[model samples]
Target: MSKATSPVRFKAKLLRPAKPANAAWTFLLVPKAASAKLPSRGQVGVEGTLEGASFSAVLEPDGQGSHWLKVDNKLREAAAVDAGDTVALEVTPSGTMPEPTVPAELRKALAAAPEANAVWADITPAARHDWIAWITSAKREDTRTRRIANACDMLATGKRRVCCFDRSGMYGKGLSAPEAM
Candidate 1:
């Protein structure tokens, strides 16, 4: 991993969701202009300081064309800020895929199913990222296991991306999103 250093800097105002929405995100939405300056238009590993507290995250798309960096509760408290605050961001690439942590269950399933494993390997890195994101995003273990099973099935059937999932991966496949509505 490359050392964290000065990165493309920007100022953006944090905003609350208009209503109850997908639990998948709660991220800091990086502006389009800032996003355009980054190396990858797809999911990227990034680290920066928000409100003086440093953070690490993946810049993902919101199914729309724009990108966002997820800010979990721990970061929010550490930063001493909340929605409606303007934040300073210094984003640098980590020189690795941001969301590549695959679950053990999914790995076993993939190993057992050659066709699915072949399809998994055949898909683009971006697609694999989406699948992993969906499987990991589930709040419950059962939900995650179901997602893993579903992913294997879909891959075996020659499907590339998950339904309702996109570049940002804020919402898992088959889950309704307020962002989309």
Candidate 2:
């Protein structure tokens, strides 16, 4: 739903990756019940309040038919909460597709291929987002690299969308929220 009449509200405990983790990412598991109100079981663009602090984020699918929000360091600081803290969240679908960030490797590949870059520039943000999602959903580095190459190849040939990608994770099991601590 675009600009929901009432925001979906929930409370979830922030969790960190198990010890020995290399990154500083934190997460909040959106309740399955709350996630059902979201527009897609896939990546959803949301504008929300976390512990009363305003923010926007893209919720990622949790692989078991739910979703999770990746709480970055900035939001955690602004919200003044940390791992192990249960906090309130109020969110509504952002009303527009959020632009996906391009990974470095893919950006480099696109830059080196003029035809692909032109096609990439011509595609809609949603199309670009799908390409990014498909590439990043690869669990293995080799698979990611291959997907990037394939994406560029397809783009160079003027393909506007990623073919056969299950953005919602309903058909393919390729995407999932990272393992929680």
Candidate 3:
């Protein structure tokens, strides 16, 4: 894996959701221009600094051809910032794609289906990531259950990639970063 030529730097105001009065996260939007410079429009691993506090994170697609950074309590405390503050951000896509975590439901389904499990084990990390993303992107429980079943069926049939999955959320509005109020 190789590093990007240079880090993409930008500044964005941190914002918190209003509806979920108990929302635990604050986030900042990456400018479209800066986001376009990253390796992928989808979820991308980035190692960078937020207000001089070094960190690594996965930038989530905003479903509008850009990305957003989730700022948790730890990072906020480290950076000494809060919602409504504009912060400096410099990020470069990680040299390697971080392995995406397999959702428990998918894991159980895969384990029960040996054919799909074999195919799942044989696929590349990126392919697996796409499959997992496609499954977890579902907005409803029923949809998610259906996707898992469909995924197993597809995998059992030797399908290596999720068909018509919009990883970047550019064409399909299936994935997006959480909205900030």
- Rank the candidate models, highest TM-score first: 2, 3, 1
Off by over 4 Å in 2: 1-5
Instruction: Please give each candidate's TM-score.
Output: 0.59, 0.92, 0.85
**Best of the two (1, 3) by lDDT:** 3
Quick one: RMSD of model 2? 2.1
What TM-score does structure 2 among the candidates reach?
0.92
lDDT of 1 by residue, 3-104 (tens): 334487888766655445644224567777777777655577777788778877767765444467666778878887777678887887766654465678
List model 3 lDDT by residue over 95-170, tens digit each: 6566768999999999999999999999877788889888888889999999999999999999999988888888
lDDT digits (tens) for residues 41-148 of candidate 2: 878888999999999888988777889888889999999999999999999988666778899999999999999999999987778888998998887999999999
Per-prediction backbone clash count: 1, 0, 0
- Flag clash pairs in model 3: none
